[model samples]
Every structure is written in C-alpha cells, then in structure tokens.
Target: MGKSRHEKRAAIREHKEARRDRCESDAYLDANSRVIKAERNIPWWRR
Candidate 1:
C-alpha cells in the first residue's frame, strides 16, 4: 500500500531535522578549530 499523508510528512520532517543537526555540528567544529588555531598562535609573553 502507498504511504499515508501523515507518514510522508513525517519522513520529510525527519530528513530536514537530520540536515539541520549536521549543519549545526559542522559549524561548531569549524568554530572550535578557529579557536584552537588562535590559541596556538599566542606569544609566550601573552600566555
């Protein structure tokens, strides 16, 4: 049998949610890497 309307909507919602979650994690990792790079660049006098 074909999927009901509710099932189709639910699948679409799940796909969107997964995409959003991946984007958020990627942003977090990018920010963290930048911070680490900045920390490594600090001069000994400033630490």
Candidate 2:
C-alpha cells in the first residue's frame, strides 16, 4: 500500500518546482508590469 522510494522523491521534486513557480510569478507582476501596461495606453507624442 505504501509508495516506493522513487515515487516519494519525485513527489518532493514536483512540490519544490511548484513552489518556485509561484514565487517567480508573484515577482513577475510587480510595479514593472503595471508601468508597462500603463505606458501602452499613452500615445507616442505624449511621451
């Protein structure tokens, strides 16, 4: 009924990879992204 050792290690690796992706996504959408989107709305003449 128990998982084998390889299955346990694979599960741990998947968990760590998911956690890393979450952290990266949070960092990716900070003030920089906000500024970029805001900039798109302005005409070239305005800037």
Candidate 3:
C-alpha cells in the first residue's frame, strides 16, 4: 500500500535531517563547499 501524506512528510523531514548531519560532518572533515552544496542540492543562483 502507498504511504499516507503524514508518513511521506515524515520521511522527507527525516531525509533532510540526515542530509544536514552529513553536510556538517563533511564540513568538519574539510570537504569542499561545492561538494557540500551539491549534496544539499543547492543551485548556483542560490549561493
């Protein structure tokens, strides 16, 4: 069965949190800004 709206929203929230944590870890490890932005799916104009 398909997930309900609330379930889908929760999943999205969890994914965002996970990505944020990864970005922070990458920053701590001296990962490139471009690479971190790419992971967060940020575009050029947004920067």
Task: Identify the leading candidate in terms of TM-score.
Answer: 1
Model-by-model lDDT, in order?
0.92, 0.89, 0.82
How do the residues 1-47 of candidate 2 rate in per-residue lDDT, one tens digit apiece?
Answer: 89999999999999999988887686676866898999999999997
List the candidate 2 regions with Cα displacement exceeding 4 Å: 26-47
Better of 1 and 2 by lDDT: 1
User: lDDT value for candidate 1?
Assistant: 0.92
Best by lDDT: 1
Q: Better model by TM-score, 1 or 2?
A: 1
Tens digits of per-residue lDDT, candidate 1, 1-47, equal 99999999999999999988887797788998999999899998997
Off by over 4 Å in 1: 26-47
Question: Per-prediction count of colliding residue pairs?
Answer: 0, 0, 0
- Model 3 reaches what TM-score against the true structure? 0.53
Candidate ranking (lDDT, best to worst): 1, 2, 3
